[model samples]
Target: MPVRAVVVFLNLLLLFFLGPSMAWASNGPAEPPRPALTVSVQQVDFVEMERILSATGNIRPWQDASVSVQTTGLRLKAVFADVGDVVQAGQLLAEFDDTIIRTEIDQTRAAIIQAQASLEQATQNAKRIRRLMGSGAVSQQEADQILAAEKINQAQLASAQAALLGQEQRLAYTRLLAPYDGVVSAKSAILGAVYSPGQELFHLIVQNKLQWEASVSSRHLSELETGTKAILHVGEGVVEGTVRQQSPALNEQTRQAIVYVDLVPSPLVKAGMFVRGDFKLGTREVIVLPRQALVLRDGFYYVFVLEENNRVALRKIDIGQSLPDGVEVLSGLVAGDTIVVKGARFLEDGDTVRVAQVAADTVPGMASVTASGAAFARAGQ
Candidate 1:
């Protein structure tokens, strides 16, 4: 072969081999395509939100009284009321055996009658003594003695009258009367059972009016006051109530205080029923987002915030009161910040996402997105 042709052939062979190697070296390995996550986002904004304090407690009568006997050593003769029975003030609830009391009263009346007779006799005797003393037929000492006897009989008559009054009062105590309009909650008095003074016979709930005694944390005490409005959850219904009072001291163990809320009359409420309620403290401007937007991981709360170029940043936030519409964002968020509402659970920090919708329209399963990147566009509108 010619020398020039050989050189050209060698060069062509080297070019074929080196050309492929050089192209491979210049271009690094191909990158995998980034996964796109479909998400719905909403812009955080300041909304009119009310600060409410939630608490749980029991329903109890506004006024409860233990009815007991005032007079001692009387047998319960009859019970006019039983548990759950309604009663009125001054109405008879039970009766004690007043036979002994009546006899005592009769005896006192008889003693008064006898003392009156003696007093009248003594008066006549004193008149005669005075007449005789004026005529000098009786000695001054004898007349004075007769007049003293008359005074003694008159004092005896006064004592008898007072005794009769006490007996009469005791007789009246045998009939148990209701102190107020209330319902009988309990009964321990049995027919023919002897009872003593101060022994409870019946339990009465005044007016059947109930109050919710809720335990609230001490931190929220300053936000509550008497006459503050409250909503009580009783059974399947809600009843309006008012904050009537609160305990001055906190519980030693729980460090919580008792708040009493007087409920308006409702058939659903009764004494001893467990209830939950919320106190409406007041309204304030707050940055809020939908509950679905929040993602709870470990022990903290987080939200996926949208950034430039379809990227998301996981943000930790301090949550405040949870309302019906959304949750109050206490911190870690600002007004007009776009946050992922739906499909945030499947995301991680700094993940690239394709926003399916924005604002109210951004809700999961929604069909469209707005031009302003609204996650809750319908909500804002």
Candidate 2:
């Protein structure tokens, strides 16, 4: 009886030791320490996306021409065209004193006549020397000397004629003629005032072809291309333009590239003004999440994702530009993954979450101060 009782006691002790261990082995891994997180998760998707580049810059004339007087120290006899005048090509816009210039021209003509007479006499003398050499009336050495003298005279006559032509051309330049058919944007010369060469007399712009010259941050260069459609903000309307060029050089101050867009012919537009422009590159489909859903920590972005076991895991994500709906995730997540869209700031790693959808639809845009969190708004205040 005693041995049996001892055996019974040992059996009871073994049962007590092994039962707990069997229960522990059946449980497997321990439950994670997850926080109570409430959020709305979204599935990532791919759709058509159009990249845009926006910047502020000034408008300018495509063919801006500055007209200046080429003749120096000439008295302005009269002014024919004024500012805002639409002139045709070759039209005489202004005149300078021709009194002294005309006299110079006459003198040049007299000099030309005198040179021609000298050249003719030299030619006749040379011909006579050649005939004398053939007939042996003059020695070969003497005929050669006469021919050299005739050539010298001929060179002198040519030099004199060229000077005369130069004087005649100067007389013609005294009259300032319209360089091209353009509107007079500016007029600087005064009546009867003597102006020097290269003095600003007028400013002209070509009749058509206006340009929206904009400087954009170099970071945005990839978003723009030649022939890309752009909208130029005008006074009260938007003008359409096609990007003509994106300069490779960057501005020193702003570190931006100069972009030129040619505007369609518009009656309401003029050059030398300010404007805002936007260019569309192309479209892309990507996974987008709201700016509010992102949790920035240690120079990286993250979003809380719910796993199948009903637990939340901190998911690191690569984010791009802010969009109207949400931020585009460049990587780190795929479609059909549930991300925490709301109450993400209050959650931590290994947090447990209950997924719920909100009635209000949201997209990625700049997060408003009031929308970040109550704590953030208070700190700013």
Candidate 3:
């Protein structure tokens, strides 16, 4: 072949092979496409939270009283009080049959009247005897006898008066009265049932006062003090209480002490109710994130943090209290760090994500991130 023709063909072949590669060198590599998953972001923020210690306990009355009668061998005529009734101190609760007691009182009163009359007559006779002794109309021995009879009459009158007072007290015992203002907790007196002395007929919760007695481990006892605030879970609601006292000694077997919390009066609270409560020890400032932002994988908690270029970086976080507001982030996060709140479970470390604007009404203490609606739609698809 001719030299000129061969040179031309080699140049053409080189151009053909290297043309596309040379053109690609003029432009940078194509930008990477955004990830398809859509996610809402929330900024970590500081929240003032209360330090709480949880404990379980039961509700009980602060003071209990057993109402009974001192008189024995009496049949109950009427029971005016029943369980769950609120009564004032000295309120009539029941009555015993007082027919025999009233009769005895009347007879003693009659005897006292007779004794008083006889004593009056003896006093007049003693005065006459003194006058007669001076006139020699009566001997010294007879005068002494007359004075002694007057003394005997005075002693008899005193005895009759004492009997009358005893009968009156016995009559008063026929009625049972409340010892204090309280709620009736139990009743044992039946209509027409005979009662014995000191036998309990009614049980009362004094002043309707109740306390929550919680068994707290000795380790946490020091953290609590009188007037410490606590909240009790009562049914579907909660009741506030204050630490009124603590047991000085711990249980020998359990090594736990009783913390008595005086609860605010609520109709829902009742003695003998088992309940759970949390004591508010103090407050602290902590970083927290929405619970949905966390992903649990292989027994570990992780979150997808927004990094530069709309990429996500997976971070392992130590979580503390899981509050109703948010999950407390103990470590691996800071104030003002953006994290994926929604759709975090579908992401991996270093994954490019299409950031979507969360609703304007975000969690308290969190800032909202904004993005184009078209990008959000494409990411959703």
Which candidate has the highest lDDT of all?
3
Candidate 1: segments with Cα more than 4 A from true spot: 1-33, 126-148, 357-381
Residue pairs clashing, model 1: 41-375, 358-374, 358-375, 359-374, 359-375, 359-376, 359-377, 360-375, 360-376, 360-377
lDDT of 1 by residue, 1-381 (tens): 999999999999999889988998889787754746887666667777778889999998899988888888888889899898989999999998899988988888898899999989989999999878878799899899889989999999899899888878878889989999989999998999887789999899999888999999998998899999999887789999999999989999999999999999988888888888889988888887778888999999999888877789999999987788778889999876778877999999989887774333334322245555433442343
Clash count, one per candidate: 10, 7, 0
**Candidate order by TM-score, highest to lowest?**
1, 3, 2
Best by TM-score: 1
**C-alpha lDDT of candidate 3 relative to the true structure:** 0.86
Q: Which stretches of candidate 2 lie over 4 Å from their true place?
A: 1-39, 54-64, 80-88, 110-164, 181-187, 206-226, 233-237, 245-260, 265-276, 308-311, 353-381
Residue lDDT tens for model 3, 1-381: 999999999999999999999998878688797785877776666767888888998999999999887897878999999999999999999999998888888888898899889899999999999878789888999899889989999999999899889878888888888989999999998898887788999999999999999999999999999999999998899999999999999999999999999989999898999999999999998887778888999999999988877889999999987788677889998876778877898888888887665545444433345553222211111
Model 2 is weakest, by summed lDDT over 10 consecutive residues, at 372-381
How does candidate 3 fare on TM-score? Answer: 0.66
